[model samples]
Target: MADDLRVDRMTEKQAREELARLAELLGEANAAYHRDDAPVMSDAEYDRLRQRNAAIEAAFPALKRADSPSEQVGAAPAEGFGKISHSERMLSLGNAFEADEVREFDARVRRYLNLGPDAALDYTAEPKIDGLSLSLRYEEGRFVQAATRGDGQVGENVTANARTIGDIPDRIEGAPDILEVRGEVYMSHADFEALNARQAERGDKTFANPRNAAAGSLRQLDAEITRARPLRFFAYAWGALSEPLAETQMGAIERLSELGFVTNDLTRLCDGAEEMLAHYETIEQMRATLGYDIDGVVYKVNALALQARLGYRSTTPRWAIAHKFPAELAWTRLEAIDIQVGRTGALSPVARLSPVTVGGVVVSNATLHNEDYIAGRAASGEAIRGGKDIRVGDWVQVYRAGDVIPKIADVDLERRPEDAEPYRFPETCPECGSEAVREEGDAVRRCTGGLICPAQAVEKLRHFVSRAAFDIEGLGAKQVEQFFADGWIAEPADIFTLESRFGSGMKQLKNREGWGEKSAENLFAAIEARREVALSRLLYSLGIRHLGEVAAQDLARHYQSWEALVEAVDLARPAAQAHRAGEEAAEAERAAAAAEGRGARVSEARARARSERDVPEDAQAAWDDLVAVDGIGPVLALSLSEALANPEERAAIDRLVGKLARIVPPEARAEDSPVAGKTVVFTGTLEKMTRDEAKARAEALGAKVSGSVSSKTDLVVAGPGAGSKAKKARDLGIEMIDEDAWLALIGDA
Candidate 1:
């Protein structure tokens, strides 16, 4: 489906499928941009896709995927660098594309703080730097470590490389004993040009843009390479401070500058949305002359107190937003169209374009989304781009806004070649000659080839070793592809037997074109290191549909062990299938009744379907328990059950499990906390904190917070306007308390 489709017009099935596609697309985009420093989609297109995902989620809240892009930050840290867990999460800022969005942001701040329109609120507006995010840690006023913002919670250590930058201060005279300065590491246009020229002169690959150059240069394993690069820093934020920097945002920036750290000189203090927008315009006007790349303007609540009160969401801060500039457009010729199969067997189309410079980067390809998109219609049959279909040999307008690759914005039909014909989308998988089918309510066509398709097999193997999964140090995508082609590592279990199979023989890895003895040994050691993996990592590495990092973690936490999880899934499978069958039958009955003009029969069929779905009590209970975990709805639960029930998949899983040393459970809960190991529920309005804050605090205290009141609930904390849940708690005779009493009980009051 086109990302621009209206959420209200979409059916629930369409919304679910779109969300899954967006999650996969955005996940890949995040990895490309953050981990590899090679983005595959334009920033504008990325933002639009995220917005569409969010809108669909909001429209159908229950249908939201556990791996929704809205809840994710940067990709996991790339291998080769030692990892660093941030003292505080390095969150991404929310974006505002229009003037109204900026205004809405301000209004949201006011509402959250319970302030009116007339309240005196000020903001700090600065250029949103287009570069890599870095965090510098200092203890006793001396620099100690620097890290790249990998995923919000963890990062890649680059201390030695960071020390090579001239702008970074090795020591500060008067600062907090422990401080973490957060900012952007950027390359100026002049420096980037010189570096690229030097690279070209030396017969090395030139970087695409200043941002990419800066990121690649900073992440280099060799500190000398980073020293040679002319990278600059602009300290704008701080994390994990022993003492407060200042009372306000502007004051903090001033303090940072006083400490010998380079801060953005154009940072300005503004009051209200009007002034913020004015500064945004001023920054945009000066963008070309700034020397450094900045894609937008950032606005932060000036008062630190307000910022603290506003708090943060899962992936972004509520107290700040990035007001993004519009995309830069350029005309390019569409040369051809190509179809690529993803791990999920979706046959995605790509538009090959004649090389053109867009936003200082050369563009050769753009995502076609799906066949519906190429045909100029959304899944709902809505006309997009004025009903102009994209074709090979047509002149297309491409645009770039942020870090990713450029995208085709519009087609110039007048410039189309006379002999160009409408492209025929293939009905068969190009890689395996298998039937490619588009299921009902699905926009993208997928191959039915399964593991037989090399493309799908390779992509799945790549996902299994991705940074967030197994993450073997020397076993990356290239190696996985090579091994797959050689038929030495066809499945997850095959990976564990590499050494025994080819360690010392003539056909060993060390004998390969690029491999040495040391490298081969290192790869073997890395694989050995992952033998005793965490249950969450193991689950994610399986490449199950709809089971992402977060969902896997959730399941791992609930099930605790691999054996326990498999048992639960096995017990729940029968009931899950029964329920699905009943639902499908009910849907068919409703459609037939509606077609025959029997409205009463439709309601009767739905009631009968619900009765027919009733399975044995034990099986139904097991299915209920499986779905009871937060974020594990019927869709994800059913997918899990089906995956485990498949003979081929289950056999592979069992083989992989047999090769492992152990699957570690999650860390133990906070034993000393008052709510440790207890399930708690919160209801109605919270006066002292937001619901999110309450939930976070509860979880931090080792409590299992539930969304609904049930027999398992140990306590309920009800506030003003408490209704159904509060009543349910009372009816069940579960212990209940008001917000104040609850706080006092937790020793926070």
Candidate 2:
């Protein structure tokens, strides 16, 4: 009755019943492990079930289904990617859990290939990455489309985002006529942790593990967001081939590697099952220290001839086997949701859960990401979710790994008490009492208090200190948030005044988390050191709406002096008034039309003229001029003119001008600067600094920045995001440089 026990020879009907039972159990177990990363039974139990399935299949050859579990090697596809047609359908591999199974597999393969007992057969071994599966399709040598494995028959189209990944070659050198490569999309451990950290910082949901993280990232509807996530892919198989390659498996893999695909470096050729077992054992022992996610090692026949002869079962082939590793997740309860404010004004809701241990780490809170997600949970009729208002007493399932924030997997309907009602969200900002409002097109709600809101103030200050911004050596987001929470820092100006708070007690600031004595001093030093920043950076640090570094530069260049810019903004009032007068005149015309029927065109035109005659002559003149600036249309002119009409803003601008230096014309405009009239592209890692900073500098110096590297690119600053750009640049024989080299050329160092 043991599951692993070999089957007794029987009638085909009896064998079919065993096959049905075995397939059901095996499929469910595999789904549990593959989709959820949760296994209901031990590996031994699974092996036993699988052996029963194989025994049944062996006895009843004609009774198998095309998609039977025994024939499923590793995984099927998921929805949300483009469906790719593989020239050679990518087949799954059959598995062998024990030494006996491996021997039987070898024997069957040898027999099919007509090999005698003395004949030799070889195999290859490679560690299987735990991640989302995808197929890359190329036609006529250009990198074009990539699709996720959605039920094997179809997938989601992610070509745009897939194009952004630098590791995936846009074009292989001396490319083939048609190439379709299969691989696993995974996140490196470092990237996974970093991704979680970023999500936590933004008050958004974090992925439970690297596999889910990679899958979720690829499935995103917004390609830009996916492009931002740290995802990597490694090719393990070939589906469609344009031409034939070396006669052996090792040779095909070598050829793939040479063709610019990231083939697994661990692939090894073995003479028999003994060597394959030895290699798998070695990989199993070394699994802990690998920087990336790995589930198991795959073993495949080294020679294509042997594999073809061995043949296939409905879903899987006789060539390969997946030896799975262990699981890495823990479950806990959801208690409450707390809102977090990110530097960019994104509001994130976090799930406060009971503590859980995953991958040796204790976790209690998971990010809900945004209000939309929380609301979606409520709509799902989850008892703990309070139907839309998560209350204090509800129990919810929290999933975690090494991720800083866990994910709410389920709500405990049985644990919902009678007193618990749906939680209510505050309409006002919790910190500053500003109206909490959700904008028409935004996913997150916000406190419109701007500089007055404690959360936004800290977030903005932290953003100013970010590496791409001012790169303040000591100030981090946590430190900024703590300072804002403690009332020690209310604005960017307060960062310069932290010394005043120190007299009260430096201990409070130091122990506030993400803050320390050395860090605080370094932060102050950084603030002081930035006193001489270019006008553009100082403008960006202000965190003003519609005002980025480029805009600031444009403003600075146009006005020449900060004081003049303020005066121009003040003088711009006349133009706004003029513009408003025109609008008023238009409105009056419409209103006058109601005075008479539509038949009197001349009368209506006269009435409109009369309405404008009443508008103040000077106001009409000012509004007209405001509408003339390039890119400054009627609406933009009115908005700028109205906002600047405030006496307080005028005063603040006056005060700000006194504390800053004027950027000389040479530095202000890019007209004749270093890169002016030149086309420069940024790719990969810049040795001098971040790509953003480098791009900004280059742009300021008059260079045009393009996303792609082309024949016309004057220079290519190759860095880490340098995927296709590097290849294209190299192919076109364009000049490339590292960050340091760029800085040296620009004389920035």
Task: State which candidate has the highest lDDT.
Answer: 1
lDDT of 2 by residue, 1-749 (tens): 22334466466666676677667667767666544444445444576677667667767778876657765644444344445544455555565656667767777777777777567778899988877777898888788788765445555567887887777888887656888878988887778878999999887997766777877787777889989998888987776777765688888888878888888888888777778778877775445446665656788898887676777766677777876543334334466777776544445677775544344233557777666555544322344344443456656555443334467655555656888776566667777887778854345677766556667767777766665455656667766666667677655655655666575456765675556877766666776675555655665565554455555556555555655555555665654564456556655566567665455456545655654565555556555554554344566555555545655433544454454344333254447566676899888766557667777788778787777777789999876656546767876888888777777777741
For TM-score, the strongest prediction is: 1
In terms of lDDT, the poorest run of 10 residues in model 1 is: 354-363
For model 1, the superposed segments whose C-alpha errors exceed 4 Å read 1-206, 210-327, 400-406, 505-507, 586-614, 671-749
**Superposed model 2: Cα runs more than 4 Å off:** 1-427, 430-433, 437-446, 467-471, 500-521, 574-679, 686-697, 706-715, 719-721, 728-749
TM-score of 1: 0.50
Alpha carbon lDDT of each predicted model: 0.86, 0.65
For 1-749, candidate 1 gives per-residue lDDT tens digits of 54456789999888888898789889999999999999777777788888888888899999877777898889999999999999999999899999999999999999999989888899999998889999999999999999999998999999999999999999998999999999999998778879989998786989988889999999999999999999999999999999999999999999999999999999999989999999987776555456677888999999999999998888888999999877576566788999999987899999887654456475668888898888888898899899889999887877753446566778878778999898889999999999999965679899988778889889989999998799999999988999999899988899999999884753567779888888888888899999999898899998887888868878988999999999888888778988677666666677678689877565756755675566777788899999999878888898889878878778888999999998999765566888987999999899999887787578757888888999999999999877668868876889999999888988851
Native-referenced Cα lDDT, model 2 = 0.65
How do all models score by TM-score?
0.50, 0.44
